[model samples]
Target: MIRGEVIEAAMYEAMHQAAVHLPPDVEARLRMALAEESEPLAREHLRVSLENAALAAAGRGLVCGDTGFPLFFVRAGSRTAVDGGFGAIRTAAAAATARATRDSFLRPTMVDPLTRGNPGTNLGPGMPKVELQFAGDGDGLDIVAVPKGGGSEIFGTFYRMLYPADGEKGIKRFVIDCIRDGCYAGKICPPAIVGVGIGGSSDLCMKLAKEAALLRQLGEPHPRADVAHLEQELLLAARSLGLGPMGSRGVNAVMALHIELAMTHTAALPVAVNAQCLVGRRWCAAIDAGGRIACTGTLPPRETEAHA
Candidate 1:
């Protein structure tokens, strides 16, 4: 059985990784855009971002200051046993959240919504969001930590429910408009990563949007051909908006676009949009049955995934 302490350690490391090291895929996307950005200011923004990433990775400091929200996605094997079962996952998450804040890897950003009371430890009810899943085959655990930025979540997330007749045109319109608005004055902090969710229930679409934005590998195309085509069209539209990093005039406003879909009610159509700032903070780690933990460059499998 894996001990709770080991889980906490793994979680803390994941948190630090999320903050200090932007994902390789995300960095690669920025570099790809950097190569094409001709506007001097826009190109400089990309250059600075690359330099910032290297500086943070080399132990100078974190990639971004606003540590936003602490989110943990965990997958467990059916054969794996923990010291405290499901409770251990949450407990370790909280412990890791507090530890990250204490160690200066995370900011104490969580608070009481109604009273606005600060815990100063970044631990409150549902502060460090945890999503859990189980698998039938593999023996151990995989966790992905995302230091989701507050700026993007606040300014770039949106939802709309339309009649089924709205169709793909409506979907495209909604997404393009959201991107135009979200990147206005560089509020969403381009070059942003955009995620779109369609055909799911309201909340499910929102969750899918959030996951698609933060979890997927940058520039990886969706497997479904139709959906992939939509992604490409919206991506080009987003870049054509004359918005660049910090509102510069260039094609560097959007780094990537991804969409996740689910079957929904026949009568209703739902869509959600989520975005991530240029920081694009995420990290993955795997813990073996013996409690040995190793960080992986590849992202963790989602709840929507199945074991092979």
Candidate 2:
């Protein structure tokens, strides 16, 4: 069985990694854009971004001052067992967030909504949102830590109960309009990654859009052809708007666009657009039933074996 202590340590390490490191796929896209950018100012922006990434990877400082919200996505195997069960998982997350804040890897960003009281540990009611799912071979656990910043969250939009008549054209129009009106102000950060969700309840649609924006690797196309086409079209349309890096006028306005879809009721249509800043922060780890751990993007090595 996987020990609760091990899980906690892994999560702590993941939090640190998420704060300090940029994923390889995202870094690669930035580098490619940097190389191709002709405008001197835009190129300079890309250069600074790359330098910041390098410095953060070297453990010198954070990639961004605002470490944003801590979000965790977990996929647990059916047969996998945790020593302390589900509560143990949440306890681990809270502990990890607290530790990250103390170590200066993350800022204490959580506060009481009504009283505006600072928790100072990044933990409070409904903070560090966790979503759990069952997938894979049912013998392991997969966890991804996503640090979503406030700027991008501000640009997130949801439209519910649209007529079916709106169809594909309406969906595309809504997405492009959001980028132009809401994101192009340089508030959400650009050459941003955009995720579009369709055909679910409002909350579910937003959740799917968030996942697509933060989790989907750069340059990876959606599996479905129709969805893939929409992504490509949206990417082109967004670029054509001339909202370059930080909304400067340039050729590259968006790094990637992804769409996730689900079945909805016959008459109602729900859609959401979620955006991620240029500095995408995410790290993932997997632990097998045997307690073997594998992780990427700055997560530290597991220090102990699982209990038998």
Considering every candidate listed, which one attains the maximal TM-score? 1
**Cα-based RMSD of the predictions, in order?**
1.7, 4.8
Clashing pairs in 1: none
Estimate every model's Cα lDDT from 0 to 1.
0.88, 0.78
> Cα deviation of 59 in candidate 2 (Å)?
1.6
lDDT of 1 by residue, 187-281 (tens): 88899999999977899999889888987888778878998999998899888888888668899788999999888999988999999999889
Whole-model lDDT for model 1 versus the true structure? 0.88
Alpha carbon deviation, residue 109, candidate 2 (Å): 1.0
Q: Against the hidden reference, what TM-scores do the models get? A: 0.95, 0.93
| After superposition, candidate 2 runs with Cα above 4 Å error | 298-308
Model 1 misses residue 176 by how many Å? 0.5
Q: How displaced is residue 148 in candidate 1, in Å? A: 0.5
CA lDDT of 290 in candidate 2? 82
